[model samples]
Target chain A: MRKLINQKEHFIKDMLDGLKFHDQKISIIEDSIVVRKVKKESGVAIVSGGGSGHEPAHAGYVADGMLDAAVCGEVFTSPTPDKILAAIKAVDNGDGVLLVVKNYAGDVLNFDMAKELAEAEGHNVATVIVRDDIAIDNAEQRRGVAGTVLVHKYAGYLSGHGSNLQQIVEKVENMMESLHSIGMAVHPCLVPTTGEFGFDLEEDEMEIGIGIHGEKGIYREKSETVDKIAGRLLSELLPHNDDNDIILMINGMGGTPDSELLIVTKYVMEALEEKGKTVHKLLVGNYMTALDMQGFSLTIVSHNDELLKSLNAPTESTHY
Target chain B: MRKLINQKEHFIKDMLDGLKFHDQKISIIEDSIVVRKVKKESGVAIVSGGGSGHEPAHAGYVADGMLDAAVCGEVFTSPTPDKILAAIKAVDNGDGVLLVVKNYAGDVLNFDMAKELAEAEGHNVATVIVRDDIAIDNAEQRRGVAGTVLVHKYAGYLSGHGSNLQQIVEKVENMMESLHSIGMAVHPCLVPTTGEFGFDLEEDEMEIGIGIHGEKGIYREKSETVDKIAGRLLSELLPHNDDNDIILMINGMGGTPDSELLIVTKYVMEALEEKGKTVHKLLVGNYMTALDMQGFSLTIVSHNDELLKSLNAPTESTHY
Candidate 1:
């Protein structure tokens, strides 16, 4: 209820306007889509879309080495198929376009519909569904969380290097196989439309395996020490094989302080060391966030030499 | 009470360990201070520090183009004179060293003591105290908040370009004079040592002109819309001049989501336009933040062509 917004209905549009104003490289298309102002070299365009609350996920990644266009919907709601089609048409070059869809029911359906529409218009398009959350039982039905940012980075780097559509798709699919993530929330975020939290819990309790949209977690328990929490998350993320290198990402779920995130990272690193897993690369910040959710997520991607190079490739995005 | 720290006493050190682990470009000095791994050219070394709660401010900004070393203290506590002296000695490369201290009583006293100690050791050192908060009436005694980040960016860029100590000191002083900032908070942040909030507020009320360390604001009033809040903040920042070019920075105070910050930026841009002030550059993020406080701060620096170019200069720091 203490959010800084004009009207609940206009939150997404107003935020996009502010984003375009702050960064001149970004432009607004049809008032619901964000695209880079300057076009990159002719290559496969990387397009992604979802609800509006997970900021710096789609729009903040629109740059020369990142996303070409980002289609945004209202708070915690999927974008319409027409909006997705518009974004695809705006950024697609002769090379083709690829849509990075998270494994959510609404998001998968809408992006698929948009791909069909774009194909009818003589534009080649492909879809890659990311379902990297390890908390769920079924991998196919798992929800994509903060690990999606890593996929975006790999695909964007490959596309910027003039890779064809099939090459980029193959890299993304390989990334999806190795990436894993799990989240725990101490507090539920409020939806702007209703001005109320999606769920409630006691002050001393936390929910494990919570989704980004305030979905119910697998279970709830009393809050424990940071090291214990990190152990729980890492147990689910780290593979059983020993002596593997990883790219570690510690993502703050919007309301957690940076200091606390670093504390969590300390324990996570300690846990990884004990398990004989070496972290080749590390990223710690609010890359993909649930609005005002007080928690954090740990993402681990088993990295080889080629994937590590792709991860280290430079991009001009504001928040990659 | 829901913080992710292991022990309150080890919060600062653990966080620094995590930071060094996350970014290979940063390293720890004397087990308490943070310094960039790569050495800069022979020039004035820029150093800044205060409490440890303000992440990405003093330590996260330590890189080739930013601070050479940052001395960190416990949560909400200033570093001792001995710790500051050690940092001064660690990064001093004969050209001289500049200390950027905020306008808090403890920080000023300790940094001044350290400067005398460094001088006695045959090392030349100078200090610049930043007091840019426009919320209070006594300009000389105003608390240095988020606006100090701008001073750091300017001084660091100049120092990295082989500027002498005098030149960097002059640039930072000019930035301090032209910069002004004001903040508001919806919820008070907790201190790790005490495990209690610094203040309290009702759900329907907000504190205007709040300080970064949970200090009381000028007045408390009912929560209003984003436009009204933006208007109040801008009225205090803008001078009486008809037209002027300024650089606007909308900084989140730790807990506010990026989505909400963008919404706040939209209204702030509108308010500046109404006042006939043109914003040349805009930086929006959590540059300097309190520990889990739900609010934001607005900083305005009246800039000319020279300062604009300096602001846009690239830096190797991870946060800036």
Candidate 2:
């Protein structure tokens, strides 16, 4: 795919610079990490980061009621430990900072190192891993996907309301248990660094249970209509949806057209409703993306009153 | 170019169903028109719509202080006069209604017919065409593109604040005079209805000044770096800047990844700043799109206090 980037090395920096211009409140520290310009000194600061291709995931969510800082790395690559440390330092207030790390080998290892580094610097930091992608049958290895946004907002709302780092961490940990996501891609995205497609598929095929970094799905199948695809994802999401009132997000994998996203949304909502699921809230858009992959993901989490309230809380986060 | 949709005939209806689910305030009337559920009883109402593929264009912009209703049509096809009439009658209050039509033959013809039909019912109504696209050398044939959202917001802001229909129309018409936009597509989008691409392009070629409905641009050229593209667009937008303060929008043509968009956004902002123009406000995202076209467009308008205030006004509009 033809990319709008200057060079592989400069991609993240240029994108962050552009992002800073898009939202004046966002500031770049050490030429990489994105931190909020005005952070509260009396509250727990929320931070999240991982591979950079997920557009609004970590960076764009840095706002008044979302993330305090986002450590963006190169496209589809985890941030370095030092950059993560810089984000931790930049957003750290006296109350402490909470790091929301997605489930990935590199991200987990780097963020863990950053946490210890921050602790060595006399700063209190709490860390929680978002293993929300349920595409894998082995739950322990599920990669974090769009469901991580809920973790940010839920944690941000709690922290903004004076919850300390420990309290925010505990609540988010609980919320993470209910969060689940599954994705299928009609087309794979090109990784800018390698100048190669994430995966290949026939014109009449699609991959299900795909990851945000273009990790191939567990299996491939002939491409089906949206209704069938939505049903396939739905069946894998929950146990037949028995009276589950959930906050559902129909996340577009960057390149999926909005019309198709909505069409998938209509079918998903209808299917959920038919199966006796009460959709407490519905979010449909490219909340988190896989570069410009043409597909959609379903992020479903059973909603409680607090979760619903937090999800509905006003956010200055660019994509929410 | 695989799409996540059912049959073509059910595309718009299914999409609207999903959109209504996305925002509870949005109500689907006649299974085609999208109107706000809770409308004020005493204020001028604003409405805008065209073909259905532009996901958040007219429909998503319907909210408090944005649009009262969005008359959606089929994919890349104008709505029948009756559907437009339904939107006009559905949103009209005793105060009056304003029709914000884009510059397209079918849209203008149908909207004009709808206005006349509404007027014959003794309801006060006015109309304004947004010919913001600067791609066409001839001003008379310019197609309204991403910049129409500005017209919607400005007029919606005015109407919601109790501006009479005539007052709102006059102000918007004045604002329209300064609004300009141009777009380029690195790749053409697939038209679902026709089962074809919007336009044809080679691997190294791109179409400049393309319309939202897949209309080819005025010229084609070998693709350049985003900085060059931004510069190319900037030069064609305004007359060497002249230290003008303006509101700028970097709109994605659906399929462009967010990373590329921010890169584009960064260059555009840098270019404008270097040209000595003050950017009062900058919107960067897929506000209006041509299906899943892989490129972007820039919309610029010199801003005064009211226009800035109107642009910066808080909106419940979905994609703002």
Candidate 3:
């Protein structure tokens, strides 16, 4: 209700307009689609999108070394098949196009429909569903969260380097197997359309495994200390063995301040050190965020040297 | 307080430890100081600092082409003269050192004392105080706010390009003159030491012209629409003539989400367009912040070709 929007109907479009105004490297296609300004290179073009509320995810990563285009939908809603097809067509080079779909039902269905439509028109398109959220028991039903950004980075990097579609797909699949993410929220975010929070949480309670869409978590309990919360989240993320180094992401679920994020990072790092696990690389920021959820998520991806190199690769993207 | 902190006493130091752990380019000197990991170049070394709550300002800006060192104090408290002197000594190359001080009584006094101490030890040092907040009347007493970051970018770029202390000082002074900033807060931020908000506001009320340290604003009124707020802010920022291009910064005061910032930016851009003013560059993020204040600040700096080029210059800092 306190959001700074002109009209609830134009929230996503207006945000895209503002994004295009600020960043010259990105352009809007057919109002709902965001594509890189530069012409697509002859390689596997990377495209991804879901809802609009999780910013700096799809659009902010649209650059030469990252996503080629991002099909933006309304807040917490999936884009239509036509919009996804348009983004695919806009960024499709001769090689192919890859759609990195999150494992939400609506996103999966719409992106799949778009892939079918694009492939029907003789464009080679591949799809990869990222289900990195460890909060749920069923792997097929797991929701993709902040770990999707890491998937974008690797897929975009490999594709931009002229990797064949199969190679990119294989690498992404391998990366997905090692990735895991889980989030907790102290407050639920409001849906711009309805101007109401998706759910209510008592002031003293916190959701332990909330989804980015304000989805119900595994449990709600009395709010605990940050150190205990970090331990709980890391227990879900860290792999059992210490054979491989990990890349950790301490992501703010949009309303959390950077100061709190750093404090959380301190505890997460300390917890990892205590467990005798080495963090090869640490990323701390709002890479993917719920609109105004006052929470944070911990994402840990087991990484080898090649994956580390891909992540550290230079990117012209403003937010990667 | 629903903050992610360990102990109030160790919050700043622990955050710095996490920063140094994540960013290999920065290191901690003494106990509360952050310096670039690389050796200082033989040119004017830029040093700036105040409180520790403003993440990614003083410390995150310490890199090869930005501040050589940042003297970090406790949360919302200015660094002591001894700490500033330690920072000055650590990053002082043979050429000289330049201290970029914000126009706060505590920061100004401590930095001045550090300058005297450094000069007594036979080091060439110059200081530039940034006072760009348009909320206050007297230019001499105006508090420096988010506009101080722009001063850092210009000053660091010039000093890194091998400008002498005096040349860097002159450019920063000129840059400061053209800079203006104003902030509004929906709620006051809490001080960790006291675990209480600096001020209280009713549910429907907002504070205009709020200071970074939770200082009382010029007025308190019922919260207005974003368009009205943007119009009022621009009325104070834009110059009388419409012939100049300006760089704009939409800074989140810690707790404001990026989505709201973009919406606020949409209206600010529309207002500028209506007034026939051109925005040449836009930097939108949490450049400077109060701890967990749900508000934002707008900063505009009139710039020409040289200043724009300097602002766009490359820097190794993680958050510019």
Candidate 4:
């Protein structure tokens, strides 16, 4: 579980420096926030962030038709209110700023505080808390996971299309209701900051419904075939609605090989098609990942004309 | 090291089935060949393939502006000539077909044999071998690696622009001469077929210049800083010619996190700029990988007007 990084204290600073080269349109500000180099003149800027281990999640989504900026925190840790404030200030044009916060207590509190701070300075700001994880029984307690990427796109599409901040927030709130996601891990990821695995699994055991920050899963079972695993995730994530059309995302945690991700994609799609559901769009790869965790997460969003258009829209963000 | 696969024999089949969902334009035929769903009416079609472990290489390059088809082999093994012939027959649209092959002995032998068979069947065909690795002093012995993707894009750009088969070959042959690449690994990957680590490393050491198939590198040393590692690869790969403008690719070998790759990209760009070289184009991410090997490769190509135009052309491939 050794990492190819310099000092732990400088891990993120060096990473921020590295990220500046990702796109000519993306640049680093305040040594932690990643913002678009060209801020569009007349649209609500969309901003999001959380812990750092989920590579390409918040930062990778920063682009022209995606996020306007991303506030990068420490590994498995939330960014401070000041850093979040900096990102809000950097990308906000004359229109307004929208904060998409994943549903973690640390994130919810900090992002909300930043929204308050910005609004206090006479800048227009709004917040949307994404809690799409369905692993837990209580909806309020479910942590946000890979499904947040969709929220980013949906909001970004609306903003880029010249929708007002209120209109975009209302549409995003509706979309969040139809989004659900769950992930399973064969091996726990090592948290670089802690120098420890988030959890341990036996040789033949796997944790189902784990968190991106390596939170312990709901339960453990012997590792199963790819078909059964995909089936299990689909069973838990398939929406109860009557809409058969849906968008499917098969995301690979960092260390999982693309071969394995491809296998997972086959089984998941087959299961959906067999169940008589139409896969409106399928995105498969490492979009959002737990660091080096050998796992895959299935994210399902009820397909609509707007969501499909949003998903199909071109994005300058490298990973999306 | 456990793989999330059903059976070793079914590995490539399941992966191929799964890859169909990557893009509507990509499809699978003959169970092992991936080709575009809509073949263009004119111009030469480009094809390439090697072993199966390097995901998104040959297959990921199959799109409107890239490869017309890719032959899938077993893990770390060459595709049979029969598979290659099937791909050639599937993609030829009377403009002739060009086969872009990596320079592994098995791949060169099989791809060349397929060209002969295709030509005997009265379908015009030609082959161009890519051996861009600069690890070994003897150019004949170097392995074709991440740099092959550049060749794919270059050749595909030519074909889509209505270049004839001979013109495409002439340009590709000249372009291959300017391509050079090198890679380093922190941890070896697991061979799904053999259920063994491709190679081994100690707690504080890394392998330099390893092959995509996990062939041992030219040497190993104590793990060095990312700056030093990037510098060493650049020292070996920089061309003697005075073309300061160049195209650079920072590729991840499967398991390394995007954060580290970004960090690696920063140092590489800095090192290149410090040398007064201008990076006309820069690509960074997991373009080629060795199963789940934790490493990175740097590919450098002397920049020219045509190469820059080719690199900037759009493609529908998911990973590129």
Top candidate, metric DockQ = 1
lDDT of candidate 4 over B10-94, digit per residue (tens): 9998998888766677888888899999986788989999889999777878998889999989988999999999999999999
C-alpha lDDT (0 to 100) for residue A125 of candidate 4: 96
How many residue pairs of model 2 clash at the backbone?
0
Q: Which pairs clash (backbone N, Cα, C closer than 3 Å) in model 3? A: none
What lDDT score is found at residue B270 in candidate 1? 87
Relative to the true structure, candidate 3 reaches a TM of 0.96
Question: In candidate 2, what are the lDDT values of residues B91-208, reduced to their tens digit?
Answer: 8878888999889999999999999999999779889999999888888999999999999888888876768988998899888888999999887898888879877888778778
lDDT of 1 by residue, B1-320 (tens): 56777888888888898887887888898777998787664888989999978787789888866789999988788999999999998889899999999899999999999999999999999999988777788988999999888888888778767679998888778767778889998777877778898789887788999988888788799888888989887777776223478888999998888888998999999888877789999999999999888899998888777677777888877788
Model 3 DockQ reads: 0.58
- Where model 4 places Cα greater than 4 Å from the true spot, the runs are A239-242, B239-242
Candidate 2 — which residues are off by over 4 angstroms? A240-243, B240-243
Span of 10 residues, lowest total lDDT, candidate 2 chain B: B235-244
Worst 10 residues of 3 chain A by lDDT: A235-244
DockQ for every model comes to 0.77, 0.76, 0.58, 0.66
Name the better of 3 and 4 by DockQ: 4
Q: What share of the true interface contacts does candidate 2 keep?
A: 0.77
TM-score of chain A of 2: 0.97
Could you give candidate 4's per-residue lDDT for residues A262-288 as a string of tens digits?
898888888888999998889888888
TM-score of every candidate relative to the true structure: 0.97, 0.97, 0.96, 0.97
Question: What residue pairs are clashing in model 2?
Answer: none
